[model samples]
Target chain A: MEFTVQDKGHYTEVAANGRLNMVAAPKLRKVVDEVVNGGGKRIVVNLADTSFMDSSGLGALIGCLKLARQSGGDLRIAAVQPQVTMVLELTSMNRVLTPHATAGEAFGND
Target chain B: MTDILARRTLEEPAAEQAIEDLHVLLEQLWLDAAFVPAPDQMAFTTAVIEAASNVVQHGVPTEGATLLLGVELTVAVERLRAVISEIGAAPLDPVPDLAGPSDLPGPDDDALLEDYDESGRGLSMIRALVTTVTVEREGDTNVWVLSRDSGQG
Candidate 1:
């Protein structure tokens, strides 16, 4: 997976593209660590361009959420496609983590 | 490749050959379930590959210990069901209480990500795809039941 991190002042937007599978999960975890270590709490993961997410990918996201929350911040998702949305829904992630229609909405700007 | 199929098993080293054999099996099933969409097909294949690879790597230390993979493809008007079973290691828990992705952390977080070099996201992908997944352990065998909706295909 290719991830581009944008520093959005109060929150950081991590945009992920390509497949987030076992192979790419480590990079994701590293990125999350960078965000947390950098003291950026409020996070928005934009998955609009992400084509695939496996259990490993989901686990990484959850881990990041936990870390971010423990640090007094939260992780939100936006622009989830149908396939990835199906995974999130089947796993009941939509209930625990809020998914917005756009990055701006997740950031509470829209 | 005949249309009417019966069950079979293959045992090989953890080399590329084994993955190739698995691909062949998946290809046959994918062709049989033509109505299933591309994403579903890929998900199912990935799950099978992950499970099978796990058996080769963790379940059996030596190549002598055979990894049993059974495939059954049933087609109806509304759905296609593919059940893959393997005689291998018993997982900590096959059907984990996953309320949401946020409820649990990745194996890597808890330091459970074994073999960091290769992939350990089989169960994760399995949970991602498929309408329903049922995992059962009987004696020494682990069975994974996967079903995909043909209508959605």
Candidate 2:
């Protein structure tokens, strides 16, 4: 899995391209942690290219959301593909980390 | 006769690469059995991946030997099935609890959503996705059989 972090003016957009499974779960946490620790508050994880995600990947996203919130910021997800959407809706984490339509619109209203 | 419309199998070291390869194997199986609906395919694929990932992540090697992952996927007219084998692995202690809650976590369970348990969730997710799942120890292998009735919506 490859993760690219682009510092959007209002938020940091992290594009995760590839399967977001156990192998890539920890990397996601690390990327999001770096963003939060570096003071990049509002975050959007772009999952348009993420084709698959297991429970480990879901756990990492939940953990990232908490880490961002605890730092007085917020973490959101955007551009979820079909497989990723299934995992989120199945696990019901979709309620907590609701997927925005697109990365550009993630923190747009805020 | 339970005719298998399509089948794919893989055996390799129980590692991350095995999971990736197993995914490709699934796609190959689907290509031949396009009669199965997308929803069934999506759910079954997710469950299969979860089971395979469990072996790669948690399967203990007996006597410090290398653990191997073996998978057999079959798509029949009525069902989708996968047998994931944990070869050269130690016995699973306190077998998985599959009868756990499969309900969608409600807004009331916000706290539960925050600190999600990765391992346990995989089992629960598998149970929810597939029609039936069973784990058995066969010699030096722990085999997980996941089956989904493709007839359902």
Candidate 3:
């Protein structure tokens, strides 16, 4: 998977493309770490193009969420695909990640 | 013996690259077995990958042996099955707890997330996605068989 980071004024948007499996899980952590370390307070991971995700990927997301929280920032996910959504709902992590319809909508109210 | 409408198989060194290749093979399998419901395909694929990933990440190799990941995916009219094998690997010292967790962690279980074992989640996800999942040692290989009833009518 490839990630692109964009500063969306209020928050930074990191768009992830392709399958987010074990192969891409570590890369995700590296990218999220960069965002948090660079003073990114509110971050949104756009998963509009992420077609698949497994437990490894889900774990990475959870790890990233914790990292952001630890740094006094927040990490949110947006535009989750069906397969990704299934994993999240199955693991019940959806309650924590709470997929947003769009990157712009995440952290919009907060 | 059931008639297989579609089949895909792969045997390679158990590594991260194998997982990437397995993903491609699954996509091709769906093309040949498009009759399977989308939901079935999605769920079965996730279960297979989870099983395969488990092999790559956790399968221990014997002395001077290179572990190999072997996958056999088949689609029948009413079922989808996968045989994920860990070749050239040592026996599971402490066999995995295939029964999975009694109760999955919830959002309120934030403490669980703090020190979560991603590997454990992979096993639990597999159990939830497939109708039946089992692991057995066959000589030098540990075989994971996952079956999901499909053909949603």
Winning candidate number (lDDT):
3
- Give me the candidate number with maximum DockQ: 2
Instruction: Please give, for residues B1-153, the per-residue lDDT of candidate 2 as tens digits.
Output: 798889999999998889889888888888888889998999999999999999998999999789999999988888899999999999999888766667455455576765578887888899999999999999999999999999942
Clash pairs (backbone) in predicted model 2: none
Measured against the true chain A, the candidates' chain A TM-scores are 0.94, 0.97, 0.98
* DockQ ranking, best first: 2, 3, 1
lDDT of 1 by residue, A8-29 (tens): 8768999999766555667888
Candidate 3 local lDDT, B29-144, one digit each (tens): 99999889999999999999999998898889999999999999999999999999999999997987877553465536576567567887888888888888989999999999
Please give the TM-score that candidate 3 achieves against the real structure: 0.96
- Predicted complex 2: CAPRI docking category: medium
- Flag the better candidate by TM-score, 1 or 2: 2
Question: Which candidate wins on TM-score?
Answer: 3
lDDT of 1 at B89: 43
Q: Regarding DockQ, does 1 or 2 come out ahead?
A: 2
Off by over 4 Å in 2: B100-109
Report each candidate's C-alpha RMSD, comma-separated, in the order given. 7.7, 1.6, 1.4
Chain B TM-score by candidate, in order shown: 0.60, 0.93, 0.93
lDDT of 1 at A6: 98
